[model samples]
Target chain A: MYQTNQYEGMIAETVSMRGHNGDVINAYVARPLGAGPFPGMVVIHHAPGWDEWYRECARRFAHHGYVSISPNLYFRDGHGTPEDVGAKVRAAGGAPDARVLGDLDGANAWLRSLPYVSRKVGIFGTCSGGRQAFLAGCRLKGLDAVIECWGGRVVQSKEELTPNQPVAPIDYTKDLSCPIIGIFGNEDKSPTPEQVNAHEAELKKHGKQYEFHRYEGAGHGFFYYDRPAYRQEQAVDGWKKVLAFTEKTLR
Target chain B: MCTMIAHQVRIQGRGKSGPEWFEVHEANVSYDHPYDLPLEHALNIDFVNETLGPGARVAVELSVDAARQLVKTIEAVLAQADQRGVLEDRPVAAEPARSPSVA
Candidate 1:
C-alpha cells in the first residue's frame, strides 16, 4: 500500500529497482484517492524522462481509476533535469532497443508487485512513450491492452534519433499478445502514410485486434493541446476514442 | 515582420449534374515558415473542393511562412493537375482505419 502526498487526493510514492542492464531504476507511482486495488497501467514517459506533463498523465489515469506507474527509463545515469537528460540522449545517439525493452519489463514487474494494482494491466504512451508501449505489448507478456500515439519509427542500424527503419508497430505486429491501437497524423513526416499502411497490412495479415487513426490535415503532435501543432477538435476526438478503448478493454 | 492570418473559404456549386450546395471551411495561413505556409496559402476554393469536396468543410491553421509555402505548393499541384486534366474535384472518403470503432 502507498500513501498520499502533501498535495492530497494524489497517491504518490517511489520505488527503487533494477532495469534491463542491471541499472538502478527509480519510478513514481500514483493512484486514485479512494481505497481498494485498481486496474494497473504502466505509463512510459517520452525520451527525456519523468517531467511534469508525464506525472500529470499518470495522475489522469489514476483519476480514471487506474494504478498508474511512470518509470524513469533513463535512471541509470542519474535523475537530472529534462534538458540535461535530453542532452544525454543526444550524446548517446538515443536509447538502444535492448535497453528500452528491458526497462519496460522491469517497469511491468514493478507494477505487478504493487499491492493496490489488479492483475490485469495495460500500457499507454505518446511520442517516445508510444514507442515504449508498442515494445511492451510486443516483447512483454500479460498485458491487457496498449495505446500508442505518434510514436516515431526510426529506420537505422544504430538507433540514431531518426534513422530510416521499419515501423516499430508494424515490425512487431505478429508478436503482440494484446490489442493495440495507434494514432497518427497524416502529415507527420516521421511515420508517413506508407509506414502506417504497412503496419495496417501486417496487422491484417495476422488477424490481430488493432486500430489506427489518421487525422487528415493534422500534423504530428495534434493531440498535444499545449503545443503549436495542437488541433483541438482532433485532440478531443482522439481522447474520446482513447477513453472508450480503455473502458472497453481495461474494464 | 511576420504575420499569421486565418481565413475561411466556402465553395458552393453543383458537381456536373449533381445538386448545388455550399462547403464551409477554415484555413490558417502563416508567413515565413516554409512547410506549413505552402500548404496553407495553396488552400483556395478549388483546392478545398478537390481535397475535401464541394459540400465538405475543412479547418486549417498554420504560421505566416507556412501559409505562403502552402499556397505555392497548392498552385503547383493545381497547375500540374490542370495540364494533366486529372483535377479531381470530388470529396475524398475518409479511410476506414480512421474511424473510431474500427476493429
Candidate 2:
C-alpha cells in the first residue's frame, strides 16, 4: 500500500477540463507531491454545490494517498458563490444526468492522464452526488470501485421522473462493472429504508458485487458536520468503511 | 435529502449586488438544505438575474413557521394598504409613457 508521512508534500488547485459536449469546466484537484504512482478518486460534490466541503474532501483523499478531483458540476451557470450557482442550477431543474455523466467521464479521464497516478480509480459522492457516482460506475469504463453516500432517488418511481432525471440509476445496476459500497441513513426519507432494500434486491438479482451500510440514528446528509443531522459516530464509522473499501478495491 | 423540487418564475424587481443595485429578473423558491443556515432544511428563496451570473442574487432561508408568518404579514399589509388607498395607481391607466421614467 502507498504510505505517506506528515512531512510529505501535496498539491491542490482549481483546474480546467473539457466536459460533456466539449464544454470547459473548473475542477478542484489535489494529490500528493511525490513522484510515485497513487490511486485516484473522483469526488463528486453534493447538490448543495461545489463549495468548501468538496474541496476538503479532495484534500482528505490526497492525505490518504489518493489523487482526487472534484469537478464543478454547475460551472455552466457561470462563476459565483456555491449557493448562488446551486440555486441557479436548481432553478434550471438541476444538472442533467447526461451532463453529469459526461463531466464524471472527463474527471476520471483527467485523473488517469496524470503522470503520478495509477490506472485504478474510484468514485464517491454525497447526497445527489452519491447517485451520480453510482451512475458513473455503471456507464463509464475502467473504474475500480464505486461509493455512494446516502444518494437519494436511485430507485425512483415513474412519478419521480422529470426532464432532468429521466430514469433511475438503479435501473443500470445490471451494468455495474465495479465493486460498489453504499452508505445510507435509515431515517432519510428521500431514499427511504425501503428504497435501499429495493436497490439491494436489484443488485442481488443482477449478481453484482456490492455492500451496503445503513446507520440507525442517522438521516440524509448525516456526514455533513455543519448540519443539524450530523451523527459523529455514524459518519466516522462510515468513513472508515469507505477508506477500507477503496483501499481494498482501488489499491 | 436533496429535494430537487424547485419552482421558478419571472419577476421584475431590484436587488443589491456589491455597492450597486441590479434588476432581478427571476425568483426561485424551494424547501431543501440551506447553504448557510444551521437547520437541516428550510424554505429557501433566491431572487436573481441570470444574465448577471450567480453572484447577482439575494437569498433567504426561512424556517417553515417563519415563512408562513411572513406570508401572513405580507397579506395583512397589502390589505391595509388597499383600504388606505395606497394602491390607487390603476393598472389600465399606468402605461409605460405615463409612469415616471427610471434612470
Candidate 3:
C-alpha cells in the first residue's frame, strides 16, 4: 500500500542528479509539503527545451498531489535559456536515444530515492517528451503509469525514420509494463489520425492496457497556451483525463 | 509535431554574438515550431559555431511567404552581383578576421 500526505503548501526548486553515465545534470522538482508519501512523476520537457510551460506542468502535477521532477535533457549541450540550448541540441542532431533512456532511468531512481515518495512513480511529457515517455514506459521498468500528450513519431513511416531513431516506439508495445494514457489532436500531422490508429492497433495486438483520447478541432501542442495551438476545451478535458488516470494507476 | 527535418550546410561567415561578431561554421535550416514566434510553424534558420558553444548562435523564424521572399531576394542579389562583376572582384578564400574590430 501507499502512504498519504497532508501538506498545506508546495515547494519547487532546482535539484541535481546523475544522468547518462553518472554525469551530473540539473532538474526542477516540485512537491507538496507533507509528512506522508505521495506518488511521483518524471515530467519530461518537450523538444522546445525546459521552458516555462514545462515548469508549470511540473507544478500542476505537484498541485495534484504528485511529487514531480522535470529534467533538463539538453544539459549536456550547455545552458543559457531553453531556446538557445534547444537550438544547439537540434544543430548537433539531438541527444541519442540511449542517452535519453539513461536520463529517464536516472530520474526514476531519483524519485524512488525521495523520502516522501510512494515509489509508485509515473512518467509524463508533451510533444517529443511525450514520445520519450512512451519510449521510457516501454523500455524501462518501475513506472506505474505513463501519459503521452500529442507525441509524434510513435508509429513512423519508412521515410520518417532517422539514424538516431532507428525503431518506432510502437515496436516496443509488447514490452510495455504499465497502463498508458494518450492525448492527441486530430489535426496533428506528425502523428496523423492514421498513425494514431496504427499505434492503437499495435497496442491492441499486444494486449497492452492503454487508453487514448483524441480531441476534435485541436492540433499539435493544443495544450500550449503561449502558442497559437492552444485549445481550451480540449486542454481542460485532457488535463482531467491525465489526473484521473494517474490517480487510478499510481495507487 | 517535433519535426526533426533540418538541412545543414557548412558555411564560412560571420554572426553577431552579443555585442561582437564571430565567425560562423555552419547554418541549419528547417521549418519547425518557433520559440518566440506566434505562428505554429515557421522557417527557422540558425547560424552557429559549435566551437563557440550554444550561445554563439543567431536565429530567425519567418513565415512561409516571408521565407520564400527571402529566397528570391537572396538569389536576385547574388545574380545582380555576378552580372556587375562584383562576384569576380571578391577574394576566392576570405580570411577570418584577427580581431572583432575587423568587422
Chain A TM-score of each candidate structure, as shown: 0.86, 0.97, 0.95
Candidate 1 structure lDDT: 0.62
Compute DockQ for each candidate against the true complex.
0.01, 0.50, 0.50
In candidate 2, residue A179 scores what lDDT? Answer: 91
Q: What are the TM values for chain B, all candidates?
A: 0.36, 0.80, 0.84
User: Model 3: iRMSD?
Assistant: 3.0
Q: Taking the tens digit of each residue's C-alpha lDDT, what string does model 1 give over A215-250?
A: 987876676555567888888888778777887788
Q: Which segments of model 3 are wrong by more than 4 Å? A: A1-7, B88-103
The alpha-carbon deviation from the true structure for residue A66 of candidate 3, after best TM-score superposition, in angstroms, is 0.8
Model 1: per-residue lDDT, tens digit, B37-88?
3231222221123233222222233555565787799999999999999998
What does candidate 3's lDDT look like per residue over A1-251, in tens digits? 22377436899999999888988999999998896499999999888688898889999998888999998998887867688788877755556678888898999999999899996999998888888999999999899899999887888777867777778888888999999999999999867889889988989999989999999999999999988889999999999999999999996
lDDT of 2: 0.86
Runs of candidate 1 exceeding 4 Å displacement: A1-8, A154-169, B1-103
* Model 3: lDDT of residue A72: 91
Report the C-alpha lDDT of model 3 over B1-103, residue by residue, as the tens digit: 3777778898887887577788878898877778878886789999887766667788998999999999999999999999988885543465554333212
